[model samples]
Target: MNASPVTIPARRGKAAFVAAGQSIKVINTHGEQVVDTWAFNRADITEFMSMEHTRSGSRHIIPRVGDAMLTNHRRPILTLTEDTSGGIHDTLCAACDRYRYEGLGCTEPHDNCTDNLAAGLAELGLTPPETPSPLNLFMNIPWTPDGEIAFEPPISTPGCYVVLRAEMDLVIAFSACPQDLLPINGRAGKPTEAHFVIA
Candidate 1:
């Protein structure tokens, strides 16, 4: 366990304060939770993780061990060091927002990952103009041979986790996705806890 671990409850957001050389482990406490994660250079928020840049640099949509998470400046910010869940993880999907759910017949205001991320980072006294699309850990969005994209139930079981090592000091923010319309969270629409440890 980390000296100061944090847990983001289902349908909420939180931040993990970490430094360069430190590692962060994201654990699906109750399983089937898709955590949307992103990070910013602690010194400069302008230099933040860019999924587009990572894909361009790594040349793979589904990252593997040793893949560098690149920033908008095309610099490595973190590296995927370990993964206990061999299921699908997504890099191209954008975090859900209020408008997304409204389109899905959600009449009431919905808690969303984008807002959660902003709130989490605000707790650190840092705010970026916009939240970048995050690395969707444990998500199971697959592209089919017919060039169609499908949002399927997560393949991750309980206790699944992934470890990422920071390449630079970062203010990492993650949200236990509050998407109630998808099977990404095991068809429960109920978010689960994610154990975040920085060591």
Candidate 2:
């Protein structure tokens, strides 16, 4: 059973400290919302989740059930235990940032996953890396036969979720991606609630 869940508001962020053996379930309260997920060792924030390590260790661009999310030290930080989102998560893309939107022709500032991550980590008395790449949950970025990667709409629907079991004490964070400039969020760009349940 899940513990009480806390909703991470759309275009915002949230985090929690999870003990080893505990798990976190990220839920798409509304369809097509992308959640940028991150994690760090509770005892050492510098040893954070590393997508490169994960892909190298698991030998998959997109992680499958039973794959482990590796840390900078190349140790399992979390393991994918349950997935109901059709494996639409992405690893190739970096988390959106203010500059990315500006380059995309947005003259104004925007809410970004990178900033969200830092803010959330701060609440736990931790600081993230200067540039933090995350496991983009519900994002659909596929590679073509030509070896080109294309961003696409998410395959996740309302109520879809993915659960990860903590392999060690961790500070887990997530951002309900606020990128209104991409189709990854179904072109709505509008943020939606993401339920984080620790069990």
Cα lDDT computed for each candidate against the true fold? 0.89, 0.89
Per-residue alpha-carbon lDDT of model 1 for 78-184, expressed as tens digits? 99999999847999889999989999999999999999998888888877658798999999998989989888878888988999999999888999999879888
The ten-residue window of minimal lDDT in model 2 covers 124-133
lDDT of model 1 at position 185: 85
Per-residue error for 25 in candidate 1, Å, reads 0.5
lDDT of 2 by residue, 1-199 (tens): 4499898888988889999999898898897899999989998888989999999999999989999999989999999999999987998889899889889998878898988998888887778865557999999998989999888889888998999999999899999999877788897666677888999
- Predicted structure 1: clash tally: 0
Q: Which residue pairs collide in model 1, if any?
A: none
After TM-score superposition, the amount by which residue 182's alpha carbon in candidate 2 deviates from its true location, in angstroms, is: 1.2
Q: Global CA lDDT of candidate 2, please?
A: 0.89
Q: What's the TM-score of every candidate structure? A: 0.96, 0.96
Off by over 4 Å in 1: none
Q: Which TM-score value belongs to model 2?
A: 0.96
